[model samples]
Target: MVVAVLLGSVRSDRVGERVAKWVIAELESRGHEAVLVDPMTLKLPLLDRMWKEVKNEKGSEHAELKAKLQPLAELYQRADGFAIVTAEYNHSAPPALVNLIDYFLEEYFYRPSAIVCYSATPFGGVRAAVQLRSLLAEVGMGSIPTLQPVPAAGDALSAEGVPLTQQLAEKSGKFFDEFEWYMRALAAERKRGTPTGTAA
Candidate 1:
């Protein structure tokens, strides 16, 4: 399955990048296509209008923005599932992640999402994952039941996102297993028939 790994943090010294690297590596190791959707690199303008709204506008600025977003929209449309990597800020998911995801609606319908939460603290940003579950459901990619939370994210994985400890390496199996199951099930269903508001 092709899983878009949405890297949620864009801070200058963000550790979430390392966490995202681990998530991507894990997905690839499981034989899934891992596409990194970094908010920092995407540089999407804040949510004045959603992708669909801008897609219909005719002004020069809107045209340019549509060009920028069109490929991303197609990417989301083709993706089998999503891995949402996030950090907690004030006990909520990061704004960059929310903004990037909020730009598309139908592209996400019927696809599954896996919440991979991490933090510098021992709590592991699970608070952010809690909020993300609801947000992801609203966008139509409801999260899988098993959440993969990396506590003390900096120490859990190396700078390159290689697992430093045996425990961290072993913990990922079930998470990916469940994610793949849902991805395949929902994808097959979608192929049989498109959901309302989603493009086939």
Candidate 2:
């Protein structure tokens, strides 16, 4: 399956990149295509209007925005699932991740999302993951029950996303297995048929 790994943090010295890199590598190792959607590089503007709303507006001003967003729309639409790597901010999910996801709705329909939350503390960004469940579900990529939390992310993985400990690698194996199962299952179901309101 083609999975988009949405990196949630854009902070200058953020550790989320390391976590996301590891996730991408894992997905690839499992024979899945992984696309890294880093918010810093994506540089999507703060959501004033969704892509669905913007695409229908007729004007030169909207044309430029449409050109910029067209590739992203294609990528999201083609993805079979998403793995959202998020950080905690004041006991909630980061705004950058939310803004990146809010740009499109139908692109996410009938897909599964996996929450991989991380934090500097041992608590492991569980709060942010909890908050994301509702948002992801509303967007139509309902999250799986398993939440992969990377505690003390910097220490857990190297800057290049190589796991420093056997425990982390082992845990990730189980997480990826569950995520892949959902991805395949949902992809099959989507092929069979989606609900009446599903996207074409």
Candidate 3:
């Protein structure tokens, strides 16, 4: 299955990178494709006054951002499911993510998406997860009931750093189980919509 993994923050020093890396490994082990979409590495100009008005047409002020958004749109459409890893900055979804979300709609429709939020408290950025869930639903993406909120965000990672008491394998096993279901259910739905063999 193609699972587009979005590290949904533009910050250079994001804490969720570890989580994303971990998820990628789990997904890959199950013979799935996990593509990373890092907003920091992909730059685009301000999108307020231009893209909305011109709407991806030629010579628009935000033509660059509009053009850049196509790949994201394409990826969203191509994937069977998605896993979004994001950071919380004051109990809200990051503006960069919000704006990019505004750039498209139906591309992400009718798919299952799992959310992972990390922060310093039990809230575990759950506040931001709530906001994101609503936003994603508005665009027609169904959120899986399962969520991973890693409190003390930076505390539970193991890519070469001092590992935690809980074995990484255990945590990954649970996460992957849900992801596998999400991918299968959503992919079945998508496949049903596709035509087979010669047109009837």
Candidate 4:
């Protein structure tokens, strides 16, 4: 399966990139194709309207908006599943991540997403993960039950983006196992044209 590892933080000196690199390596080791999708690279504008709304509008402005969003749309369409690497900002997800998510709808339909939450604090961005779960569900992606929370993430990872200890490795392994299962199952179901009741 093709999984998109979404780096959800775009702040300067953000550590989410380290977590995303680790996730990509883990997924690739399991024989899955993983793509790194950093919002910083995408540079999507803050969302003000849905695609449908833009399409309905009869003006060059709407056309321009569609053109701008095309790359993001195509990228998301290629992925069978997602690994969302997030950091907590005020007990919630970063505004940029939410904006990126809100830009597309059908691309997320019936897909499975795994939340990888990290933090410098002890709670490990679990609060942000909780909020993201509901947001992803609204976008039609089924979130896997197993969450990968990297507590004291800065200390947990090496400079090379590798997990530093055996304990962290074991925990990440379990998370990957569960995520892969859901990814394959959901991708198969989608391919079979199963009526998931969540398609847009």
Rank candidates, lDDT, best first: 2, 1, 4, 3
Q: Give the true-structure RMSD of model 2.
A: 1.5
After superposition, the stretches of candidate 2 with alpha carbons farther than 4 Å from their true spots are: 197-200
| Model 1 spans with C-alpha error above 4 angstroms | 195-199
lDDT of 4 at 150: 90
lDDT for each candidate structure? 0.89, 0.90, 0.72, 0.84
Model 3 agreement with the true structure over 14-103: per-residue lDDT tens digits: 777777787787788789989987767666544554333445477765566767776776787788787878788789878776665665
lDDT of 4 by residue, 1-200 (tens): 88878788998888888888888889999998898877798777788897656755777866777876766677678788989999999999999888878877888887899999999999999999998999999998868998889988888887667998676887577788888888778777776675755332
- lDDT tens digits, residues 31-120, model 2? 999999888987778989889998878888777668877887898888989999999999899999999999889899988999999999
Candidate 4 global TM-score: 0.89
Worst 10-residue lDDT window for candidate 2 reads 191-200
Query: At residue 67, what lDDT does model 4 achieve?
Result: 77
The predicted structure with the larger TM-score, 1 or 4, is: 1
Tens digits of per-residue lDDT for model 1, 1-200: 88888999999988888888888888888888898989898788888988888897777978767887898888888899999999989899999999999999988889999999988888989999998899999988999999999999889988899888787888779988999999999989887887464445
Winner on TM-score between 1 and 3 is: 1
